[model samples]
Target: MGMEFVDLFNQWASSYDDTVAGKDPEYREVFEGYEEMLERLANLSKSPVMEFGVGTANLTRKMIEQNKVVLGVEPSSEMRRIAKVKCPEAAIYDGNFLEYPSLLTPIRSIISSFAFHHLTSDEKREALQKFREHLEDDGEVIFIDTLFKDEAHKQALIQDAEKQGFLNLARDLQEEYYPYLEDIKEIFVEEAFEVTFEQLNKYAWLIQARKGE
Candidate 1:
């Protein structure tokens, strides 16, 4: 991750939870059913998990509540500080998706939420390859994030944001590496993973993938 994103997240650390809780009208739709999405992701995950971009530890808290052993990696120090306070039992480290501390145990489930879009398509692929290296043979990779059905769908969303006069949201849509569904699937397949997607809301999709036998 770049220093700009780290700084951006560091700045967002204090109010990031509020934004996800519907406090920001522009992003409310993006985070609608936020708790449900986190809960579902937690439920789908297995113990000895490694979570990338574990911002604020919201999902980490859920996993810990379920008695899952979790190791969280985050790029922003502020986010890590907040997450550590929120999820003291889980070991949260300083790292990004493509680079993180080594795990002692083979991770049974690798997970994340609302953070993968920070990575470009190639970065995402590299992260997936690294995940495959760390996961147990039958382990899964689960994430809930903003993903579009296709390029046209992504463009439509940007247009809608602009039409609604949400310049920030529109700019986010245009600037972020929010990926196309087909592209994500192709990367997973090429990386030898069988993947599936379930739409949780208009903006977020739950992606569950496992290594191909």
Candidate 2:
């Protein structure tokens, strides 16, 4: 991530929780079932996990409630600050998906939520490679984010957002680096990971990928 994104997130940190909680009318559908999605992701993940883009530590809190050891990586200082207060048991660091402090031991799982779209396809692949390096041989990667079934599905969403007069949502859909399902599956396969996807809501999907034996 770049300084621009960091600044954007820094600015958003204060109200991110509210936005995700469906307080933002325009983004309500996008964040529908927010609590359920976090619970599902936390349940799927294993202990000694490393979570990227741990915004406000919502997911971190869930994992901690499950007695999972979590290391949170976040680029925004403000987000990290809030996350620390919310999830004091977890270690929250100042870093992005692609670059973070190295772990002394391989983690059992690598996880994230809603934040993976910040990276482009190439960057996603690069981050996956790094994740492979940091994970145990049998570790898994779990992420919940907005992903399209295909190019057409993505376009339809953008058009729908525009029709709803959700200009900000429409612009975000157009500007972000959200990936196609098939493309992400191919990338995971190429990296020797077995992956699966389940739609959690109209906008988000749960991706569960495991390292190949």
Candidate 3:
């Protein structure tokens, strides 16, 4: 198995919500800026929203008040199972981002939390294309993930991981993610979506891309 995403999540699901989002992380601070970004993307009176990877109800808990309806889509069965506890009222889907119109209710913003990076480069491009096709001209896509400084920086993270039980896990994850981000950033720039790169602690890259008509 490349990485048992389901099993990894299953191990963390019960306490995942509290550890990742509930506590004060840079991501939580990033949430503070999203409403301002809503104004930049689509200043709509009412627009349905979707979270492609709503992990442990992290960002959803913050965004619930902004959008009329928040649809959370998570592929991890463990995450899906626990999401109900974090966000009982918000609609939860035990699947990945569904193209079905019934699943997405005319969304203005499609956002995810540390989830998009789990895909491969080809998957990233394909997913970005899908995001473009689904979004309206003015709609926006928000992707939150990690961006390392360089190979040495990544090695440093792996070195640090040695002290933790998940040293190999961290190494494997870094192997999976770091290569494609630069290419992805270029793609975003070419797509006419204003891209500003920022460091959100260890796990950075809060990308905001609006569909330009």
lDDT of 1 at 175: 82
Deviation from native of the Cα of residue 202 in model 3, angstroms: 2.8
RMSD of 3: 5.0
* Native-to-model Cα distance after best TM-score fit, residue 114 in candidate 3, in Å: 1.1
Residues 16-100 of candidate 1 have per-residue lDDT tens digits of 9999999999999999999989999999999989998899999999999999999999999999999998888999989889878
**Worst ten in a row by lDDT for model 3:** 37-46
lDDT of 3 by residue, 1-213 (tens): 113365776786776645554353423432444444333322332356777777677566666656557777777778876777877888878666433235434567777756666676666666667777767777788766666666677677666665565545466646665544567787776666666665545645567777775
Per-model CA lDDT versus the true structure: 0.90, 0.90, 0.62
- Please, what are the lDDT tens digits per residue for candidate 2 over residues 129-211? 98888889899999999999998999999999999899999998888888889988999999889999999888999898999
Instruction: Report the poorest 10 consecutive residues by lDDT, candidate 1.
Output: 1-10
Candidate 1 pairs with clashing backbones: none
The alpha-carbon RMSD values of the candidates against the true structure, listed in the order shown, are 1.1, 1.1, 5.0
Instruction: Identify the runs in model 3 with alpha carbons over 4 angstroms from their true place.
Output: 1-4, 21-46, 97-104, 163-169, 179-181, 190-192
Candidate 2: Cα lDDT at 103: 89
Of candidates 3 and 2, the better by lDDT: 2
What TM-score does prediction 2 earn? 0.96
Candidate 1, residue 80: how far the Cα is off, in Å: 0.9
